[model samples]
Target chain A: MNPTLDKLLGGKQGAIGLAVLAALILVVFPLLLDAFRLNMVGKYLTYAFVAVGLVLCWGYGGILSLGQGIFFGLGGYCMAMFLKLEASDPESTKIQSTPGIPDFMDWNQITELPMLWQPFHSFGFTLLAVIAVPVLLALVIGLTMFKRRVGDVYFSIVTQAIALILTVLIIGQQGYTGGVNGITDLKTLMGWDIRTDEAKLILYFVSAFLLFGCILLARFIIASKLGRLLLAMRDKEERVRFSGYDVASFKIFVFCVGAAFSAIGGAMFTLQVGFMSPSFVGIVPSIEMVIFAAVGGRLSLLGAVYGALLVNFGKTYFSESFPELWLYLMGGLFIAVVMYFPNGLAGLWDSHGKRWLTRIKPKANAPVKTEPVAKPVAKAAPTPELETTP
Target chain B: MEWLSEFGAIAAMQGFNGLSVFCVLLLMALGLAIIFGQMGVINMAHGEFLTIGAYTTFVVSSLTEQYAPAFGPYYFFFAIVLSFLIAGAIGWLVEWAMISKLYQRPLDTLLATWGLSLVMQQTFRSIFGAREVSATLPEWLMGSWNPTETIDIPRNGLFVMGLTILLTAIIFLMLYRSRWGLQVRATMQNRVMSRAVGINTKRVDRMTFALGCGVAGVAGAAFTTIGSTGPTAGSLYIVDTFLVVVFGGAASLFGTIASAFSIAQAQSIMEFFMSGSMAKVLTLSAVILILMMRPQGLFSIKVRK
Candidate 1:
């Protein structure tokens, strides 16, 4: 194997893992599921974008932000605003009091578009704002908290508070933010209808490809020297500070990166789902996003994707079959995962699944040289214990 | 001067409303502070414990009405005590089953307790049918105390405030002037040393957690007088309760009261001027900004480790 290829793909096992996941989503899911079901999977993959980011920030960087939904909502809202503006052209919205503004604005009796919503009219600006708005918010939050060394449980609580605040702000400013119902009836994007079946299929493939790009980007970050520093900071913050590193800067960077990933996911979500709401910007959704990362094996980028897919599948299946049982099961999953499976699905695979693989590998006449998976991730073994001790 | 007098009356009314809010916040924050400040554990299900108390009170009220109509008015007092006991007992059980295993992992405790809260919420929905329920207050708890022509204060507000004062005093006395308090403080400062000195540190932890949850239950009972109880009512206050505890400095009992008082007053006064949601947003934002500046909170102690 080429050294560069080994480094890029995290060895042959990791390469195979990536291929299998790609096949499962891009080929298998699309082929098997109908358009509606395929759209739902695409929606779940969008969340996987946020999960992959959490792998870096929460898993490796040791910053568990319970407010990723804020970024996701912002990204979605930005795209929705652009789409809403296009949908409410003077010709189409001739019936409303205000000929060109969104229907909600007209109902609220606003004659002119608010200064805040002005820039979102441009598709180019909306696309940029999707990532930029969330990153900017993350930067502000990260600078204030990380610079002051506010972290762990305190940081989580503060982020949760921010989620609450954002939700309230959005709801209170209903005239501007569409109240609690969020930005809806996002009919078109650049004159292209998004509600059609063909459009949904195209959007699904687009989301899947974007998600792959994000996963690769995360993998690249993890393979860099900065990844080692993140791990080091997580294990021993004081020691890293003592070693003359600006510990907070690295944390801020990783957090901003996580925010960007979530924002992209949010944008894709608006495109596919047809609306964005404050419901997605609140504490519950934020915490649920964290669980996606937790269930995926926070340390494993690939595992995060699978975690999103699996948990969402269970959610749809259970909620449809037995609505009451879903909350119980979800609550139980949260407890069980933390208590028993701290490292999540990938951890289980590393411990149990890899053994089965090795057993079958010999029988299949595979070379014994592919034994590096065990050694590479062995450093992760002590982290769960370390987290508990802290 | 007439308008000025009217403004004065409005201020007085809103201030009293703020005071009632302060009582609820203080009651909620006290329990959280004890668990978070002293025990260094984040019980995310603390709010659900409050809900448990509310439900317990509801059950007691209905039972009293059915079996003993004459005992209806006095049932509230009994319900308050029962709420505390029931919630404390559940807290004790939770500590044994889950919290003890997670004593070392504070973050995991947050997630697990959150899970516990979800389960509790679902259970409430299952039992209570998801509709908001209110306890039938006795005749004395209804109506208002008219201090003047323009100033009318709800009798229930005064009752809750009085209850809050009684509980706060008891908690202070217990923490400062009791043997159990000493054990809790010792365990808080140095668990190993406390254990070595013949203190059953585990018992202290369980009792401390139970005590915190019991206070939350009492808060819930008090809550029934002012507003209706729903499955998610407790969760609505959880974030605010946390902010109050955090803003007050996690370890300081006095700070908790002061912070809760200030925050409640600020929010209520703002509500008088602006939308309720905006008031909430402003209050929380101010707290977060101040917290960012003084991350140790309003009155954190400096201890040399």
Candidate 2:
């Protein structure tokens, strides 16, 4: 009983922490916010998916991918293509020279649907492509780069370049991609009107549930011995390699998983936001995704969710009132987070909030003895890392 | 014979354009390499400092045009000097306040400096407004050189190229031949030993960082001749600057120049035939592929792990 609970939650503290976050996501947010605000929260939650993946890939495996938006966009564009095909039926586009292709394509004088958009006609195929394409691309990148032993900074630059290339391609190909405007005017999903308020509420819950499931999956991975090995690799690469591990394969696996995770977020974002664009696939947004991870506490998956919410909320609030000031606040957050709070909200909670918790609830100390001990701090904390991730 | 001459003129003009891009890239990449390759601090705001120089040039030009019209022809030289001094001064303060504490954490430097870049960009927007502004070039720097009827090179482009060559020579000499250069190199190679030998490593660190930023300011001054400057102009070139520094092998000045020259020329030439976005895609993909094959970069720089 104890071991199963530990495996699922790390310890009693992790269990309680996860429960509180789950309650807030499920209850507090929905109850307080109006439909519009809830929808904004849903969009921010999508970014949390990428931030959670960052925690796994960067925090543990020591692979910092600055181009996560590539996978996100790939996943989103795949879904967008399928929806666009559904929307652009021959009946809807009869006014154009070409009746079967999308409006943008007809506007650009494209007579027929391109071969690339044909496969997306099938929902099942599109869904599979969303996950498979990003994973495949990430696998190729990981294997080629990691095997050659590229350093961290170089890997980051290469990923960023890939993001830039993808954005440019999407923007340049007006007829094929709808150009810089991105694929829009999405109406239905599987013949159901997704534009209704009721439908949006349902989608929000669905997104939240999927995010929790990802949180659990991430929690499980970090709790496993493989996760520990990943941390070891980050701290000391040669020492971990000397201990008879194929570090390259592990790195590749994590990268593929990270791609898959971000892809899921992208798909959900398309569903909630009802559009996908090259703007999200570029360097600026990709780097902003990293900031989401950083602000949430790079080591904590749960912190990532809150981080995304808080930052996005601040951005929306400030930009609405004072457009120019938003940049200053965001820039300040980046500097403050990096300089003083590297661990992010999770770290702050661990260092300061724990003492407060101890004072408020004496019963919480019951699990302290049962919790696992530290490994001596080596630039990272020795214990309570599980507390960071929900 | 007429058609041949037309093609010849096209090739010559493109070649000159490529040379200008190469010069700008080299100047920017040199500053970045010194900060990143030598100091091992990835200053993402290197481009912002370069922007500072461009803005400085703009300010000087506006001043000379409005207040000191007679000084118009010589304003550019003073602008370059002022840009170097102001940017270098800021670099010194940044090193003192932020950079010194974060040298042990390289990735954190990328984050902090990125934040710094955004702040600087927003500051630029606030000060200069969101619109792009171009500086007025002196009469001597304007127009083109008609070296035969078939070939004409822009005078500003030639002047910028010459400036690049002169600065490169100066940087090479300062880094290798000067006493301060020895101290900086020694401290970078072995901090403890250099400190023990009375190198004043902290002072060396500040000076080296300032010098790199100073050169970037000069690059920004050169940029005014080729393109318009805006709040986000520095950002548009920062990533490309980083790629150039990395591809060249961070440690080698010669490698930086070679990579910059090739990247500039390739992009310039391809842009003529293909769409701008396609050219970027092709060039970036090629660079990524090459980097994969040779992860150590075009040249290897050995340092103890």
Candidate 3:
């Protein structure tokens, strides 16, 4: 009834969708799944953060970054660093050649903690670094590429190259970055032992809350006038630039937002998974993250979340049962989605599922009669406010 | 005097090694340049095509060894030709099935090609098993061409170099001197206009893609001389190949050659001094920095968008 609240929730339809997703994630998942499965869901939710960011960056802004994993890894590594330092206290590590530094460093014969690892000793600083580090890198990339008018396939290739470079650098600098094994044996988080089931459950809820917060923030942005400009920019860059709207800055802004969201996801992932590795920070994982958004209906923020869950579920299940078939299935999904289902599950729902729902319940058909006329506008333009879910 | 001569020999050997690398890169980048630069289609499965060639060589080597041992030495030449034809045929099929539909959507094409690459990799894994396999080279292709005591170059390296030179020359000749080259150039410059002028632009696109893929197959055959082939071997070089093509300025074949040479040399030289991974990181960083500064790349022609 209240306009501001209604707008924040993306009108009545978005409100209903948000409520259903919230109930599914917070209530249903927790009630139905065991701690281990719920933790896995939490991990998937962290990826959902990147998927949501992709919805804004690739779907709305049309800047397809194939390197969101870089930001996610940066955030995860930052959190891992702080936890690793706390775990590597002089008491627990007295047998080592170096008492206070990470075990990987000591293994590599380094005596002193590197200058880069020193600041991560402070949790406050680590928290800031998680977001700031990724944003800074995104800023540099955005400024360089966008300012010079490098976009489309060029930007994607450059980002993919950057992901490759970061992965190689991390793996090569094994002593400093824990090499290929990644930052492992992470036990405590600021004196809280995260290995416990109770701790895992709490963390899952915390992640759920954070995810909802991100979705709302994304919804707020999409509802604003700035969102319209992003749509305009995606469709016709020249027109937006000619209209004196400094198109590059808007691009940089959305890209940074995406990077920031991915970084948050990364930090949460480390907290839940207890480690971070180059396997997650490379071209493959980065592109897989894109597919999460793709399968979810890139245009719908909530759909991206579901896409991440469904794809990761399939990956885990198929890989565990039939490892040989997983890659083929994943590959097939990518091709099939691109060819026939570009709009993803959400689009399918809009085109067919909603019509079926109305027909089943004729009493609700009156309100739905007006929807078909407005449906094309929402489907065609995809201004987030107009997106409806049943 | 003895030490100076030894140092000279080592330098010469490393330089030759660099040259060998340069030849491989040029072969890969040449195919990529035509596909990405000329047609504006980003084929992420380009590496898989190389794998197709490599696997084709592997199969030919085994078959020749099994039933036709007398044809061992000469089988390689036939294999190379077969690799080109097979890879080109698959490329033609891919163009018809998937690529032609996504010409307007470059990003989607990238995703779709990546999918194609995954499927191809799985096929390789299924057929060849997950282990790395190499072709059995003939005795003449083994051993070294020793210029000095420390500067012994493998004969296979020289052979690969010759093959690269021959292919590069043929590609250049086909691109510049032939009637097909004119149609390709015309199609690239203005597809709609070329179609209006009675050029079968669609056929040109298909042929150009297949030719690019065929070149990749030849590159794969060359690759077996220097390294073993695996299911994902092609992917390892995809980024480097793309960088070479980008650095060379996508549209120019000459630029691809130049970029490949410089990049391979830089990487090999740095590799000699530092750890191989560090050398790669530094070389790639330098390339990215340069690319950021000059987004059009090293050898772009001025053309109005």
Candidate 4:
């Protein structure tokens, strides 16, 4: 019985344990927290989804996509459109409170909704669009950019430019896309009162579940043969291309996957918050997502989640407590994180944990040799890369 | 005959507006081009420097209104100089403390500077509320000149154009003629070789960054005369600034000037017919198309492998 227990707690058993722990945390967290706090946590977890995508693309794929916000915004707007349609009077197809149409559309006198917005009226279609739109856009962009071999700073500039353009586009199409004010004051989702405690809890649970599922999927991909190919491409793009692999295709695949993840995050974000706007897809939000991944440590999926939580929690706290000083704190944190903890919070854990334990128990040093066997392989791989490279 | 004359007059007015936009774009892009082209850092906080300058100008105007009415129109000039210094000092400090450390990782600098930009924006927002501040332009700067009864050109816009030319000449001389300029160029071209030759590459980097930021501040000061000043005014210039830098090809002042002229003209001309947002969309679409056709931009510098 002891031997069976040991086996269950060893090797792949540890990963299973971590997964179970994560699942438990996700499932039980909202139950403990109040509705307001749970909603906020849900938003942060949605951001984590975007950060996780960034970790895969920017962290591992060596592609600095500054337009993840564009995907996030697209997903959000999609969901918002459907929710707005759902909440509207069925016969009139317009909410009486929102005169003519959305505020932006009032100026243009767009009394009739555009043909494209028709699909969004359905909950199921809107849900599909929340995933589909960002992925489709990312696929197109990735295909063009990677196929042309636009990497490094050039890719960064192009993506940033794309984000700016998208923001402008959304803002300009105020009739359909709610200009700068964005779509807000959403009261219901598929006949459920979104403002109620029960609905908020449900949304929180969905976000947590989606986050966990994404982490698992990301882990699976990272561990697969395709994941190895991605790492090889990141490490040596030319070599990978020379080895008969379609580097562009691989990049596009990863980029699309990342975009899909970000879209799911965005969908969850809008549903929880009951709002969507052009601000979500702006350059600032995009940069913020990248920073979350960077400060958390890009190499590990867990790092992305941790970074999003830490940075966002800091944002909420600072913005609420010391609004003026928040920017300074954020800047200082960015500089400190980059200079001191390039590997992020996870790196700090790996570096200091052993020493801390040793200091606490000097007599336990006999088992020092056995400690290496228990360490995650992911933590070990990065050390060689750091030493060998810059 | 009357309709033809009216069309001609409208065309001329738009041409002047295009030139005005070009002047602002040129000033903003020159600084970005120097940083991105010379040193491979895309200083995302470049626009925030502009904001600082604008705010400084606003404060100067307020101070002059309250305490020193005698300073009058010249107060704008004083604000411009002070803004340059203030922005430059901050830029230098940032370069020395944070940016200098991240030279090995250019992309990381993008994120760091972005964070810095946000902080600056929020700081400004907290200090000056979210509403747009009316930057008081002296009567002399506010009025327009009527070359003909039908053709009225803004006096301040003309000032901006003249300033653009003067600043361009000054920057050209400073970059090419000065000894420090040579050292900066040397470091920009090859850091290892410059170090081997006993050049203070670190000092050059800080100075260059500060100088670029100073130029951006000046652009912002110049901008207040034409546009509204606010906490998020910097965001308006960000896209145009990047477009100018990327389209001009990084590192080349000549390319920046050329791209700024072309893109600004294209945007203004399109704006004459279409809505402002549509015009921006058209302009960006043109830039993307251009980039697709010429990935290296109009002027590609020779990079040593």
Candidate 5:
């Protein structure tokens, strides 16, 4: 092996080995764990989807979108709406009289299904809508925002305001949207009985598969030129603009991609949980998304996944074990994360990895660093030039 | 002519209601403005601080009901003070423990404060049992003051208006005229220079944060008179409070007061004409349009680049 490749792979081997071990645990542990625990992990995996999107937008694109929940909620609601329609008894013309119309709708006397809810009866359309609606919303908003050069704190505030408005809008539309009660009592997903243990296991497997796919996709994007351009825009937008890149297009693209990922997460979330509500898309949940990404290490894609799982697991455990003190504990955790670990857990591992590598191979690394610049530099430049020429 | 007279009476009632709403909104936004305007920290827990104050008021009122029935209406005054202190103490603790560390990182503070709000909410829920606490109003606060035969304004609302004006004046004086105000302004404008000038920047941050929380607490106390108190009640006010603060511009005190007056009036008028939820949606949509036009908000001061 080349000396550079040897050095790169040498240090990463332990971390990669640990990751593979963790992956094995994840896949095998579900079989051994109870259905409830499997379901919890499934939920965490769905959340990890949102976290991955957040990492792209916030970690790489320099956009602190505190409205991932809105997209997530939108996707979930879309799926739930379909499931509700499918589950509704067609013989019962008195849909309004039906308790399943949601309590708020029953209160509102919405006797008939709204025209917009008609397409949701189809599973395929519902799936498509789950992905389409949030991405479309994000595309429009992102285009407008980025075109106006809204960034930093201003961008965060705008997204937060959007999340707030979306929540309120959903709640206000009591007739069709189910208002505060939201869409629940979901019995099935595309003919599969959702309540069954076997179905639950399948959902968990699907969630795990989707999560792995998202991680791989995110890693692929980060390795691509588009990701490089995004990072460049984040680090120095004006410089990138001067270098002939459409910064707005890049931002809008990444933002839409992020929104789509969040929507997918939401769809999976609704399928697993059998419910969707306005509460999930509100300002509080949106902020929680940011906190998860932040605590996990926004810079690393893996960190985002780990962070979501850890924070959510903590939330589930704390809320169950110590319901009253859960909030205080979460608050304390946030404060501790912000004050002490600005670079987050991933940064800690990165530094430790470097230190360990140096201790193990100090002599080998020293000679390579001091003796090696000419050949690599000469070889690296021509590859980029060849790509550009082509 | 009779129809016009009926419309006039309705409008007048709405105006008074709007003013009362404005008072609470302005008070809440005043604290938000001071923190965001001065320190640039979007304190998401500001509403929770208000909830804390309302809870304090409930505790005080309960104590008075138990111990000193003769004191009666006067218990409200004690509750107001105690609420302010309690909320302020929590604010101080939050600032010292969490917010102080996230000064340069305003976005981080927003997330941290949001977490704090959730914790506060859950704590209150665990303690208060997730139900609306019905606060008893004194006889004086119960009835409406009849300005005309058809138009009657609630006495409590009028009191709230008066309290709002008095607090605004006091806050204005302290922010502009006092030595601490000078230090605060100096620090807000240039932290390094303020520190160089021997100002205790950290102390200013704590005190300012506390002062803002105290105002929110007072607003909470005032709110108990008009609205039901519950663990989740704070969430209702948060969006409205943020709208007021953002509409007014984060740091501009006068802007906060102005925006509160305008937004409250608009919302009330809209509510009279439309459904409550529709009115809120309309008002928020209008605010968004206005923000897109003027992102700095109305009466925004140009800071040094």
Candidate 6:
């Protein structure tokens, strides 16, 4: 490997993990899997976005948000709104009472476009909103909760309520939000028919590229000096505060970042799945997203993606064959994961796989190991879950 | 004069509706308050245990009506006791197998119990089928009483309220006035010290959990009077039940009851004017706001952080 490329990859393990993930997602999956299976993988990758976000928020920052689906849903809805507007042009909607509004709104007897849906008519605005909406919500929530030092279980519960509230609000305001069925019949993006097989294949690559870009961006953030603070704050927040840091801002920042990541995933989900709905924006899905992060190894960004895919894969297969057995298996999986494997998949890899990586390439051995970055993460390992990672 | 009477009748009905809702919530919260307040173990599966009580009632109700029609009218009392014992036994097994090792980790307990809830729900679906079931009530539980030509109340509502009150009084007496209460309280405050003083805190923990679950079972029994039983019924109520306990102050029995009363009443009254979902959305929003404003909840006891 080139010296510059080696430095870019950080270590031998990092490079190998990157190659395997990239090849599988970009080349192997698309080649081996049919269009239907590829679309399914695309759908699963959308969840990987949430899992990665969870790795930052819960695994690193010690904030377990059970409402990530809200942000993901918001992002997806923003994109869906744009697509729906394009599909529901006056020419296409002439059969409805209203000639310009969405079919659902027209069906529900909404004569004109609602105030909120108007902005979504602009693709540029929708693009901005896909990231902005969730980040803004997280900002307010984090500022309110973290400033008051309401955290851990309280934070988790409050997030769950937010998810519950959002779902109820959407279902209740069906004329505006598309209700329990959600914003569906999304057909195109900027006159390009997203419903076509070729377009879906393109969308798959676009999402795959975007996901890898996010992984790189997250890695950049995690490798910084600020990343060290997140680890410190997770374990000994008092010491960090006593050491004279504004803890609330850091907490808020990581949460916002996580929200942004989830939003991106949600947007991609709508593009690939061809719909955005309340089914993805609730407590059950949100908690399931956390389990994805947890199973992937909360501490490892790469592991989160695999975790999401694996869990969803298992779910799809199991529910198909034995619907009655699915809940028991899923329930038992949660218990088993929590009880036995606190460190998750990545942590398991680190214990065993890291040694092999070092053996294969001696240059991956680092002077960074001499520093204090290693200690706080070990301390952050609570009784049931978590393990140190650097 | 007619309009005034009409208004009074509506108010009277809504008040009973609220009171019935309050009774259900209080019965659920009381059990939660005991376990959560004393041990600080958040049981996400508490709702499932409540389902256990409900299904037990359903089974007994069906059996008596089918096998012995003469006993159908009187089998409810027997069903309640059976509900308590079955739910309590499950609680004991759960405590021994799962919760005992997870005492030091509250959040993990939440996750594990959640898993347990899923398993319990699945078990119910497999055993009873997925559709909702209701018990055959005795003839005495039939009909409504009219205080005046304009005002009326369901007999079942009043019966449930009566049952709730009886259970509450019994629980309060047992938990506060008895020697066992002293031991439990002692263990709750200082586990190590209580053990040093020969309190057998472990036994207290198991008994406390069993008692809390047993109470939840009775709540489930009372629930059969007003609502049908389904596998997911417990789940539908779990979040609201947790809110009642937390908003009332996790450790305070009176607070739990007070909070439950206010929430239930608010929901019932709002339900008359708004969509049921909207009413729930508003109530939950208010509760969340209150909790954020006073993170300790409405009636929190001062303890060293």
Which candidate has the highest TM-score of all? 3
Ranking by DockQ: 1, 3, 2, 6, 4, 5
lDDT of 1 at B100: 93
Predicted model with the maximum DockQ: 1
lDDT of 3 by residue, A283-362 (tens): 99999999999999989999999999999999999999999999899999889999999989888888888877876686
- Model 3 DockQ class: high
lDDT of 6 by residue, B40-137 (tens): 88898999989999999999999998899999778999999999999999898889888888887676777788889999999999999999999988
Model 6, CA-based lDDT? 0.88
Question: Per-candidate RMSD vs. true structure?
Answer: 4.8, 5.1, 4.4, 5.6, 7.8, 6.0
lDDT accuracy of residue A316 in candidate 6 = 98
Clash count list over all predictions = 0, 0, 1, 2, 1, 0
Q: Per-prediction fnat values?
A: 0.76, 0.70, 0.59, 0.39, 0.38, 0.59
Looking at model 5 chain B, report the run of 10 residues with the lowest lDDT sum.
B288-297
Q: What lDDT score belongs to each candidate, Candidate 1 first?
A: 0.91, 0.89, 0.92, 0.82, 0.81, 0.88
Per-residue CA lDDT of model 2 for A60-102, tens digit only, reads 8888898999999999999999988888888987888889889
**Alpha carbon lDDT of residue B305, candidate 4?**
48
Note the DockQ of each predicted structure.
Answer: 0.84, 0.75, 0.80, 0.47, 0.39, 0.68
Question: Candidate 4 on A18-115: residue-level lDDT in tens?
Answer: 56547645756656777788788888999999999988888778888988998899988898888776655544434544453444455566777789
Candidate 6's error at B81, in angstroms? 1.1
Which residue pairs clash within candidate 1? none
Question: Model 3: runs farther than 4 Å from truth?
Answer: A363-390
